[model samples]
Target: MRAGTSPNSSSCSAWRSEAGPGVRCSCPRPRGGSANSISTTDVPVLPNAGDYTIGVSIGTPPQPLLLNLDTGSDLVWTQCQPCLSCFNQRFPLYDPSQSSTYSPLACSSKLCRALPLSACHAQCLYLYGYGDNSIAIGTLASEAFTFGSSNNVTVPNLGFGCGFLNGGLFNNESGIAGFGRGSLSLISQLGVGKFSYCFISYDDDDSKSSTLMLGSAADLNGSATAVRSTPFVLNPSQPTFYYLSLDGITVGTTRLPIPKSAFVLQRNGTGGVIIDSGTAITQLTTVAYKLVRSAFLSQVKPPVANATAEVFDLCFSLPSSPSAKVDVPKLIFHFEGADMDLPHENYMYQDSTVGLMCLAMFDSGDESSTIGNFQQQNMHVVYDLDNQKLSFAPARCDQL
Candidate 1:
């Protein structure tokens, strides 16, 4: 996001001034960030299985629903009425009929045209798929979206997918709130070029919540910080995914001997490292994974190990209790211009259900590397889309 212009004032005024009447503005009172700059809205993070979800309301009366804040894809969608197939959800499905503000987009609409593979059948239909094979096939509709605790701040006529047929590992959440760099994404729709998020350790107290800020508040300027930023690589072919230049990783002081080209963008516009909030575990290329895994084992030597968890590559029994701290060294991710030192808890997970400690990273072959949300915990990460850079600063996420 660009700095200086306040989302609550100048930028918002510019946005609303362009739109004609009957469009209700729902801008919130700007919270102070640096005693002068507006602080970002803090949305409570709800723990769903291993994923982190935030509350979002849609429709006329603002029906409350929880959705995953995914940065990988671009489509803010929720399970709607007339489902052919859907996951068992904690909340009721969103019924567009109940909301007077809800309106379906036409096939010729600009929003529908922005979609990658939009289908026209009276209503603009869309088929959104995830890397996990989760598919959401539904109609594209626009409605008022309310965010934050008071639910007073809203974005009217926001484009979202009303998923009539959806299936995924969405445990209790309704659907995903896309923050990617696509035309129909919330970020693009709002025209806020900047956003930042601070994630807390999932295994920690559930009482504490994570934070996501939009607009000028997401800027690193006029703040006390140790922020490092790197240029974001945008592939015209895959615009939704935010690709970062990852040189190599370091276990404490020793940096791994991985080839630079191993993390480079391939001829197919793939094979670069991505910072994904939806993926629970971090994934590395096969060759890079082996080197890091071996380095981790040599440093953190745990005893009485067991079989790896269904997803995690490394798992071991805690010596004494679940709270017992493992002497794991800090994992430093060496990006092109930034060196993010991940805390021990950020890279390791303690399964409270089974009382086992495991490395929360895996090898997903040589397709592409991913820096998952787990590794992003306790870090103030700022995504500056306008500048095409990402900045990071280590902090206690709970405190932030």
Candidate 2:
């Protein structure tokens, strides 16, 4: 289910915007399977709207809904029955009463106090808000969570938000499955230790869905490639966010002349870099964007069209001939311990139907720099919380 809207959606502002296997998947279950073992061949994730969605079955009798998988947020919620203020959704609202496993949390429960913004009326009521002002206000409750349509795997007594009043640009996703590093997040509650996903390419029209690997399967897959790991930079004040050290960026062979301070995460938690699946495009700080914009434009071939958008600062016309190569230069991101030379399509969104090509990154002004899903297409990324590190390897996600 897609819920997040583009950052700075109202203006030129850069808008941008899992889990685990406590239980086994299709495989046989033990007290706990091997940490490196591929325990579940369970969930089927699809690219929905501009974001990604996965099938989640909640409740005892199994009520299924599509949920947005968000690494940027922490809270598993959906629009439940009795919507107080709900956005028009595509699927039927989740009816808690119909399920035998439904159980609301008490106000005094420690899980209810996990997030600072949560408040209690009679029971534990949570108020989850997004940077775009989208909010989900409802009760915090525990229910059985199942993955995949066949219901091969389930986690009983999983804590999640049952939204009664929710509104946002969800693209009709039922709600969100937050995979952030927060205690209340689905990933944390499941205690999967490690998880991984490979998003199907946006251009892949075959309509095939990808898998969300948990436990040892993700790590074993990592062992096969030219994988590189980067330590997660912690912001003590805001621990839920997965921050990384971005060393620098390069256009072709020339590194932009941006200051190192541009990417720093201050004590107040103002600016830093995060890998977000909710956002469609990459977003950079104003200081870095200006230098990168200048560098990219300086290298493009002459006769470039003056195409532009409210969010993206760079745009150009693609050659009319189908066989002609788009002359966009190679863009590279220098992370703390690795350099990712993005596929041409990853950094540049080529809307061939309109013969337009725009740089996939947005200028996020003074806000945090976001490595959105656009830059992560056809990329297999693994999050190892036990080691507190992030790893990546380029892959044909359609096949994964």
Candidate 3:
């Protein structure tokens, strides 16, 4: 599901916002599934807010709530009952009192120690601040989380944040369902050690939902198309972010003169490229972005004009009669061990009302870069934490 918000939200900073219980519970094995895998279908939600959201069922008597499927954060949280002050949410608030499985953590728990300057009282209370300045303050609890599967397999006593006060650019969604690499992340807690997802086109109005697979079934190597694999780097300082070694970028057959060192991981663990699902547009280093933009503009010479839209930097205005031919070049990201040849639809976004198409990428002021979700559409991407590798293969996500 797609939620609407500002297009520039792709720059949303990385990292989990709050701390929660490190508790984990075993989920029932899925039916007709492999001995080691469990798969969940994620519903795609499109609000006027422009953010990608999914419906998650939590509690003993399932209470459905919409949340952002974020890879950059680590804690799965939702606004709960007895909200002292909460943002306006579209979905119903989760009430722990109504569920027999809901269990709030104690202040002295080790999970609370994981949080920065966490405070304890009768119940374990936590505070999370997001990159966009959004804040959620509430209790850390564990409960049964039911994924959308044919058998409705449920993961009991899963740790999560129950927000009593939330404020930020949530776009009315309940909260965030983090899939980061931290111990409290969905993948880490479930002990899946691997996960994968494929996003459909953002313009696909008919896209009902997508699938996020956990365990062996998440592997994309089974595809007929050869899956390109790349080394996945891990930094202890920033455990939540997934770092990739991007050597350079190519427009069609031409490889731009981007220095390999520009993509190198810095000692601080901040200077490198990361694949993030929360961001909507790909962000490149200032040097890399300029080269890519210049090369693309030279190849596709549309009318010399600025984008009327605030979010995009490069845009093209078409003639009175829409032009059938828009020469968008292929974007291939040269990683350390693999190259991802992206489709045109991944790099270009069209505003039909204005007859304008913009490069759905941006320039990052710092050395760090982000490969946004838009560029990953219709592609099956696998994250194998156990093997410390990332792989991908092109596929029609909707049909998959």
Candidate 4:
């Protein structure tokens, strides 16, 4: 999950106020099965909140593991034995020696070719970067990764990164487990055709408790608001990206027309309005950025200056008034034949630094409008890989 409120009790109320409404869904849970019978539940649906934990395993015995979940990247690496230097977290590092199933892919392997042995070597030797400059690096190997309660499983020769050193805000975590669409990614290797991940945040006090689901739709508890699957453009040699034809953005009853150039379509492996569970804040282009920021700031009280150089255009001071409120005009994303309407809170939050500075929920520095964990707090996001479509539904994200 994104960083929490600063270590100050004064701003506690502000944080809770900014949480908006929680999300809850009623999707069915998964049932265990064999490799051939591996249904949705057998697929790994790693969590992207709290200390950045997800499930993984090492060796033929398949010891359960929980590592950070990252979508920007496509590789699912884990810590291995003989880790000279590695960061500490809740889970134990994978000891390759103990795992009879562990095997390193040769330099000639297709996975190595796609990532380029050179890049793989760098990742193995250096640090992996995360939001807020968090970094970690580890080795790569093949192992059994189990999912669901009974642990119906799939054993693939996956790339595991054992992060030894870290800096900035990620010191509290262990290592990263990438969920991107690259050949090195766990999903690609597992042969789980298409799957979707839904994030449901716990109470503001327990942001770390937010849950993530994979493969099946068991964890999601919302009506299926399906939309046409837009073709996800794969960067050939690079990882895959989800792409959608964004016709326009709407706020309330007003539709803001942004030039196609204003938004980058299918640049990264991600396409359409790419949703990144890793980023702390949402990101939008200049045109959509200005429009959304202006509308929010106009309705709220006096404006606050941008906090960091990468801060959004508008921010609200949370502690000043009787909970400042603004009508967040629904921002609608127009796809090919369907228009998805997003709740105002999806892009509005109370600034942690400033007591009452409610701002347009996302930052402006990222290349695309990444729908981060904060925006995904109480929503069910569907990724239809086979059909090449995506869907969304409102939810109440609360602890069970």
Query: Taking the tens digit of each residue's C-alpha lDDT, what string does model 2 give over 37-96?
Result: 224645666777678887666776656567888898988899888777887654567778
lDDT score at residue 331, model 4, on the 0-100 scale? 68
For model 1, the stretches where C-alpha displacement exceeds 4 angstroms are 1-42, 220-225, 308-310, 321-325, 351-355
Model 4, 230-312: lDDT tens digits are 44444543444454456677766777766765565554443335556556566776567777666655655455555563355
Top candidate by TM-score = 2
1-400, model 1: which lDDT tens digit per residue?
Answer: 1211112232223223422221223544422122112233445455556677766567765665678989998999998877788787655677777778999999999899988888999999999889999999999989877655422456678899999889877786789989999888878887887888877767666456655677776754325548888889877778899999998889867899989888988878878899998898899988889888888777775763665443567776666665566788778889998888877888877666675677778897876899888888778788898899999888776665
**Which candidate, 1 or 2, would have the higher TM-score against the true structure?**
2
The lDDT values for all models are 0.75, 0.74, 0.73, 0.51
The global Cα lDDT (0 to 1) of model 3 is: 0.73
TM-score, every prediction: 0.85, 0.88, 0.86, 0.73
Where does candidate 2 have its weakest 10-residue lDDT segment?
10-19
Rank by lDDT (best first): 1, 2, 3, 4
Q: Return the TM-score for candidate 2, rounded to 2 decimals.
A: 0.88
Query: For all the candidates, what are their Cα RMSDs to the real structure?
Result: 8.6, 7.9, 8.0, 8.4
